[model samples]
Target: MSRGPKKRTLEVEEIISLYKKGESTTRIAELANVSSRYINKLLLKHNVERRPRGHWKRKYHFNEDYFKTWSGTMAYILGLFTADGFISQQGQTVSIAQKEKDILEEIKRELKTTQPLYRNKSTGVYMLYMHSKKMKDDLMNLHGLNPCKSNNVEFPYVPQEYLHHFVRGYFDGDGSINFKGYTIVFVGGSYLFMDTLQRILNDKLNIDTNLVTDKTNYRLFLSGRKTIQVFAQWIYKDKNLFLERKYLEFMKEKTPLDLLEDRKFRNTKNAVKLRKQKFLEQLTKTNCIEKASSLIGITTNTSKQWLENDSDLKEKVNILLNNNK
Candidate 1:
């Protein structure tokens, strides 16, 4: 007796693509018109790894009110959304990208969704994305985010109690402290969003900020030691929720004005005047070369040679050159 044609699995590329897009084993099987066990076998055959069973199980009965409440975690999620999340109208999907895997996992856990975070091998960027019309609607209607909200995004009305936490999250997303420049600066493409943040900084912490318009975006800079100190203290009050590296830098002992003054003092011409005074004095005298050479503890030949060759450093560096002969 002759058997029917042998069953062949779907293309390996197609299977891998669907799997990476957060498709479950059962869903992949259904899409391919094969049994779930067969799909698992194909995945193994193709060297595609499987996620944990717990990662594939759906936990919450997702609804419109799933993300309606205002909480610290919610505030943080919103902040992350503002910084890196994208809403696609075509697919009704919400996608967030980060280099850190833990953050992507945290977002996945908070949503209680059974979606895998996909990794971009080229950029090493991990993206946690899902398709949900409810989430897109919530963000659009509740938070007032637009489909393409790069340059026109606004800060949503968060509760008074959770506003600081929300701002902390936003800061973690886009804000950075320049320890070298002694400034706490927030950078964003949206002018309105940056302005709103400036207002929040003033009203919430009584810290003033300067708004600067860059070529591509807006910058809200809280310069000076006192201002940045207040900003750091207010935002980092509950340090557990923020990016640890940034928080640690903000909590560092050095003050902005102290660093600024140190830089200023070092860069000023007066700072080096004392050291060059003897050189200048010697250069002005009749035996100027000899005097400067004595001060520098160098022989007259090296000083004469250097002075004769380079006029710019004739006086200042004559004392620094030494002669062996």
Candidate 2:
């Protein structure tokens, strides 16, 4: 008589290693060249406390079919979800957390759901959650995100047109901009995710970024006045989709300032150059350096110095003045 299939053998270390790395049962099965049922059996044998099926409460519900359409709001939420949302293994609940209550409120409004927002008093974190498999599946199917996603979460397949909005949402969730030096940084625990974001930045916006890894996570940063300015405008194309405080911080970065003796401004070199050209255009209409200086709120001496130092400006101003006369 032919013997039944040979007894399947599994190495304890191999199973434990994959599970510790946050691999799902399905993923572990693929890697181990075994069935998902076998992987579950090993977990049971090891007494691993697997994730529960559903959330504790079931007071509210939502029609997450709204997530099917591709809109800026949806794209933004997708980014936010990828950054902070988690789907339960039961596929019945999707949860997101942040420190901003208004963002939670905004998410409720966007999904048109009646789910109540929760706050952790000890941690000061605000949460918005729902019991909807549709939402979870939408995220997984449309965006390639899965349940129990944390450190190993990969970047989603955002549409080419909505990439900016998607990244903006991600930034609003996990990014920080420094007012002191105007540095833009995005922090996450996934090296793969950061690497994909860096590639998108270069491909979509032509922005070059540096990828630095700390002990726990990765940090993607853009430095210098020019790169920061470009990235700021690129991410915040839709102001309504972002956190108010973060948007205000960006506004502070975008605000124009008076010219300094060193020809400095709170902007990149290109922006400063553009402003100076505009100032000269206004001066051209006046036909006099003193009047132009007055129009720009700069002293006549400054204008004279600029004219002496910048031959291009001098030539353009002279031509305009002659034509006006």
Candidate 3:
């Protein structure tokens, strides 16, 4: 027998409505002009489960139109999503889980979703899941993502400038670091997915790595201290969000402007000029640009580009060609 101010039937229904809709007791009480304790009693009397401390503050839904944009944050989240996100075939539900809640927190913030991160009691994995047909359709129609995406997922198109953010997000999701062995590795189920990623990375970063079959899945490994260090610098460049523990693991051996000297020496004007001189010397010896480029371990297109871009090189090459004739 709870003895309190007896509310009208309408008010009680409205209070229940608010409670069901995730309104906090204090807020509901304030809205209803009732005491917090009275609101709690009312909710309990009606058999509504009490939320945990601060749980009511969580938004149970996400921004439905979040995946429609192409920002860096969106790209990164998409990358993370591509790595570990799952789509349920039964409905328009998508979920991403992580061992570290920090990355999930970052994803939530980026998606502008306050959706509660639920933890599995058995596996201890924190997952942020949402049910939105529009979002799921966008993911499928726009990115070609589907249910049971583990084995057949394809690499989605990412803009060139946001490539690092995307790959960093993917790394945070599916990549690992071997501190003692000095290796950076990425695991994936599809061979094409791994191969496409490898080609992009190799073309862009000049990273030499091994792409091999790892039992069922495939792995791309960038081994050795120099390769891993360069990769860390490349991926972590101007990054705002990443798995902090992984970032810290890479940071343990890094210095301020770690690759400054290497970049300086390699990018010096004198170095380019000297290289051009060496190419011209090779051109004089070989006569054919392709042959000369091969002799100097440069590409024929590079030799052609240098000749096109440098008038001095063009004149010297003409002189060498006339001599060869």
Residue by residue across 18-80, what tens digits does model 1's lDDT show?
776666665556435577788788788888877887475333233335457887778877887
Clashing residue pairs in candidate 1 are none
User: Which wins on lDDT, candidate 1 or candidate 2?
Assistant: 2
Give the better candidate number (1 or 3) by lDDT: 3
| Superposed model 2: Cα runs more than 4 Å off | 1-58, 254-325
Candidate 2 per-residue lDDT, tens place, 141-174, comes to 8778887566888887778778888898899888
Clashes of 2: 0
What candidate 1 gets wrong by more than 4 Å, as runs, is 1-66, 254-325
TM-score of each: 0.61, 0.60, 0.61
List the lowest-lDDT window of 10 residues for candidate 3.
256-265
Residue 33: error of model 3 in Å?
45
Candidates' lDDT values, in order? 0.67, 0.71, 0.75
Angstrom error at residue 255, model 3:
5.4
**Model 3 lDDT tens row, 129-248:** 776778899899898788867888888877788888889989999999866546677989988788899998889878676666646888777755566677888778888788888887
